[model samples]
Target: MRHVVKEKSLEDEEEESLNRQRLTSARREALSLYRDILRATRFFMWPDSRGVLWRDVLRENARREFEEARFEKDPEAVTRLLIGGRDAVESALEKLAEKQRHQIQKERGDGR
Candidate 1:
């Protein structure tokens, strides 16, 4: 009976350790996503409708969002958030690139 109990305890410990490792990995991924967001914001040097810098606004929103999700424990939720954040950032950057390309084409057409 004692041997069985010890084996069960060992299994529990292994599971707990795995959970901790998963949490650590999730944290690393979240931090990386946050940094990517901040870096991307720097590319938007223009101001918004309120005349405030878009970079500052984006940084603030990103920080708030990360804070709000800091306590999330569910692995699935964390994965979803990370994916959604990445998609949003990629979409915004792509739109900005398209706009710039359109502007360049317009300028070249005018030049010609």
Candidate 2:
């Protein structure tokens, strides 16, 4: 019984350690995604007044989404959220790039 209890305690410690590592990794990924989204928002085209509004909206939405998932304990759920956020950031970046490209082409009279 003593030996069995010791083995179970060791196993529990290992599981706790793994959970901590996973949480740390998830936190880092979440922060990275938050930064990337804010960076991408800067590239969005808009007048000064509307630009501020857009930035605020984007930031608030991102903050709310992360906050809503702040208590997530499942590693799989965190992974899925990270993947989805990454895809969203990539899509936004691509859209920004395409918009800028078109703007430049139009200015050069090549978009006519």
Candidate 3:
């Protein structure tokens, strides 16, 4: 019985260590995504209908979303959220680039 208890304690310790490592990794990824989103916002110089800078709106929204997930422990949900956020950022930038390109073409008399 004593030996079994010792073995169980060791297993528990290992599991705890793994959970800590996972949490640390998730935190790192989240911070990286947050910073990347902020950096990407530099391109959005336009103002919204509310007269607020898009950059400010984006930063605030990102901060709020991160805060909402601050205590989430499910690894799957975290991964999904990260991926979705990244995709949204990339898509927005691509759309912006397309509009800029179209505008440039129109100015050059090459757009329809």
lDDT (C-alpha, whole model) for all candidates: 0.93, 0.86, 0.92
Question: Which candidate comes out best when scored by lDDT?
Answer: 1
Question: What TM-score would you give candidate 2 relative to the actual structure?
Answer: 0.82
Q: Residue 15 lDDT in model 2?
A: 90
Candidate 1: worst 10 consecutive residues by lDDT?
Answer: 1-10
- A best-first ranking of the candidates according to their lDDT comes to 1, 3, 2
Shift in Å, residue 55, candidate 3: 1.0
Whole-model lDDT for model 1 versus the true structure? 0.93
**Candidate 2, which segments miss by more than 4 Å at Cα?**
1-8, 45-52
TM-score of 1: 0.88
Number of backbone collisions per candidate, in order? Answer: 0, 0, 0
* Predicted candidate 1 versus true structure: per-residue lDDT over 80-99, tens digit per residue: 99999999999999999998
- lDDT value, residue 35 of candidate 3: 93
Candidate 3, 14-80: lDDT as tens digits: 9999999998998999999899999999999889999999999999999999999999999999999
lDDT of 2 by residue, 1-112 (tens): 3555445588899998998998998999999998998887876546455556666677789999999999998899999999999999898888878888999999999995
Superior candidate under lDDT, 1 versus 2: 1
On the 0 to 100 scale, the lDDT of residue 102 in model 3 is 97
Clashing pairs in 2: none
